[model samples]
Target: MSAVRLISNHTLKLQPQRSSSQLFRRHASSSVAEGSFTARRGLYASLLLLSTGALAAYYFDSRAAIHRYVLTPVIRHILDAENGHKLAVRVLASGFAPRDTQSDDERLKVQLWEDELSNPIGLAAGFDKHGEAVDGLFNLGFSWVEIGSVTPKPQPGNARPRMFHLMDDTAVINRYGFPSDGHATVLARLRARFPIFYQEGSEPHASLRSNALLAVNLGKNKTSPVESADDFVSGIRAFGSYADVLVVNISSPNTPGLRALQSHALLEDLLGRVTHALDEIATSESNKSRRPKLVLKIAPDLDEAQVDDIAKAILQKSVDGVIVSNTTVRRPSTLTDANKAEAGGLSGPPLKPYSLATLRMLRARLPAAVPIIGCGGISSGADALEYAKAGATAVQIYTSFGYDGVGTCRRIKDELAEALSREGATWMETVQRASAELSLKPEDRSAHTSIAQLTKEAEELMRLVDELGERVGGADPSKDNSATESTGVLPVVSNGTERSDFVLFSMANARQWVILDRSDNAASPCIFATLAYEAIDQGAQVASSNSKGRTISGTLMYRRGQLLERIPRHAEASEKLYLDYKIKPTGDKDKKLIWAIA
Candidate 1:
């Protein structure tokens, strides 16, 4: 009976163990199921956030409140500047940037090169270092989208921390050194774009877009010889057919000796080679007129003489246009940013003055046919207008675009349009007017007499006058008695062979007065004689003539090139007068003398 009871207790214990084991299994299964469900929920939530973010990026305009208050701040705070720039480029390439919805007003249209651009606003080169974002930038409403400081070979460019933001000055400084994706890569991309762009019902060729143009800014590789034209020539051959304009970028300060290309000899060689390459491309093309316009981009730090040299080279080389200017190494005192001392080219408001001055100087030297594109420190429509007034056919924005965002082009266009309307003008009209008014006119550019030349001529004239005076003053008063009937003065008129007029007076102090008449011939010989007669009548001292005739002794004042013989102290010396001329006749039979001011 004890054995039977123990067996029953064992069975009872086994039953409880089985029930507890089943309960534990159920709990484990339930926990696994809940864990899997939670993970799936988290993944869905993440996907939703990503989709929302992508949508916001694509749909929102760069000018939207979210972009200004949120997106911009987020980008600036989250990423380093150079990386942020990369990210922006990537975003644009991905077609996530907002589309330019606004069409330009008719008044905003302008002509650059042979094309008629929808607006005068354009994106300058440095903004797009590669051809990766040409169409992307164009989508943002830039009529002219310039790409690449493209080199013949790939280059990393400068070093880390090479770019800085001067937030206080709304500027940027960069030592990018023309980082480019070589000619091969850039040319391949452009070639790809070319076919698609010109296809039926596709985006128009950059040249076909009226005033819209696509330009490639060619740069020399850091390791390449600075003076060699091979790199730029290669670039022209590679991209000549694909671009509307080809910009030879020899102006970047970051490059060790790139700016040296601005030297007359080097620039001549560079442009000549590039032009030859362009001609070759044009010759190969079925359409002869479809060649790219060649432009030269120069630095803002150039002096007047340097700029003049560049202008001469441009005219000599037959370059199509010039972009007046790239960044400057100069740091203005007005720069309040700590980055002011950074070692790189300075750009933004500090650059405006330098650029405008350079542009004005360049305009005065360049012919009206070659247009100048003004760049540097332009942030507003007013600034664009200022550039126009200074003789720019078109204006480009760079530092301002970087600081402000993609909406910069649109904003500038709006502002420019409004200003143009206020003046009852169009962009074409304003540019035309500015070009006509400010550019060097043919008359102003004509050969002028240098001060040295004028001085030399004046000295020669005075010497001749002195010899003539001796001839007249030493003559016998008795011989010319018939000629001295009126006031005992002889009137000598320059013969008809001369273009200039002059008068000679004999003074009592043994000094002869030579009136250099630089006036028009309206003053007849009779009038000139009256001047000498009037001086004697004004209590004038004279030499004692043996024939009882008096010789006038006093200074003669030529007022406004009109001969006025006056007694000493009769007129203030401060009066605006030509230089004094003294002459004593040398007894020459031809008493007529000529006066030449220049």
Candidate 2:
């Protein structure tokens, strides 16, 4: 849901960050005074240092002044969370909306449906745990939003610091373990958003807020033994009447015994019963005309066979949709925090590729029409498009929005729009087709470079061989087949203006370029994307278009946003080499990517 809060910790981080900045400022001032010339001047500098030290000491120890000063004003900016919380209790709060024109102010209506987003995008399960923030999150603009892992009895979740912000890490480690205020608490919150009350048998549900398309992520209680179906059913049953969609969460790494529920036999039984229950609910509501969509959020750490098993279970069970992944147990090679040794799954940039990999696998194995909500490490529009390209129908962003705030959503949407437009499509469906052609799986990543380069080389060689056979003829076998075949031609390089033997090639002493044999250094899941930051330096035009050839590898091309084939790496070599294309310099193409030159 939204960056899984550690909700209170959001304020906690801000306090510490301010103190760290002050400490640095004090250190800088004290160091400069060491070079002063005269005794009187030195004494004055000492006094200034003392003043700085007191401020530094006060700040580092705790934010006594900031809490008294800054927080009151900051909270005031959000129309006062205090007042907003009151609005939660008082359904008839004044000044919600609608003071504008109607009949006379007719305008041309553009029925623009959001490019049906197929990226790893969806709301985190708990952001609207009670469905309280659904409308608000939608107002901020997201393709889809998730609410709840709502429990029947309501849960307080794990204890404090259950959620921690690993800031320098650009990650969050949380053990929130499905804390929710319960079905009634959320239904009340959502009901308050509406102008009318909702009738649930004799009960009523309504809210002043109701703008978001909701997907309800459900889980078993910490107290409940995950082995049993009764616990899960209890939670899912309560929200059935109100939820727009229901997600069976069998993969929260934080929750004890959560992954155990992911076992195929256990999962099939659970899903079968759950879907059956929802099916009956839908049937009963046929008169009322509403049936909540059923979806599932699984873990990223799952292996291929495990994914296949789950996919099979989903199919056999007749379930609805699937969210590709949850947080990761494996930390990345890029993790900079020494404190990262602490327990809990790692989320954010390190999880993007892994999450996308799971998504691609699901798309390949699962039946079509089984909608997938993508989530993990999506911070920008390009990242969203990458998820879309990887076969996500829509994506959920938690970390980026957590760090960057609500503005991140609009930024991602705008950027994704730009990406779609660049693909020569004004509509999202077209972009999705383009992305489907480009999606790559994780196992396909290793040979990305060699496969791409060799393919381009092979194409050039084939073209030349065709010309040679026609020119020389079979009568002069040496001049014909033997000439180019027996002796390989050196590739012609193109300089800025035209083709040449020597194009300016530079050697890079880049530290990151060193690829090690062991898993220790390359542990970062994003090592591929990290290397891709240097893709331009290799002077190649890379485009991901899903295609098939025995020699071509999938992993390499997918990183460039091209997923031409679903086939894994070839065990045997073939004449048709598949890989990224290395572009020769030409003034027109060379100028397009400025970074490629230097």
TM-score result, candidate 1: 0.65
lDDT per residue, candidate 2, 1-598, as tens digits? Answer: 1122244646522222346677799988887676554666879899999878755533332223432244333443564322423343232123231111111111111111222232223557644456655655554545467766776668787765554456576677666677778766766765565446445422221112232355667777788777777766665566666666678888888778889888876785576557656655655643145556678889998888898778756654546678878888888878876647767767788788899888888777654445566788888777877766666666788766555544455556556666666766543464347345543223332442343443443333333333323221222333433323212222222122221211111112110111111111111112211223333334423332212211110112123222112211111010011113221111111111101111
TM-score of each: 0.65, 0.53
Q: Cα deviation of 488 in candidate 2 (Å)?
A: 60
The regions of model 1 sitting more than 4 angstroms off are 1-60, 196-211, 286-289, 443-598
Report the C-alpha lDDT of model 1 over 88-120, residue by residue, as the tens digit.
Answer: 788788876776777888998877766677888
Best by TM-score: 1
Candidate 2 — which residues are off by over 4 angstroms?
Answer: 1-121, 195-212, 285-288, 430-598
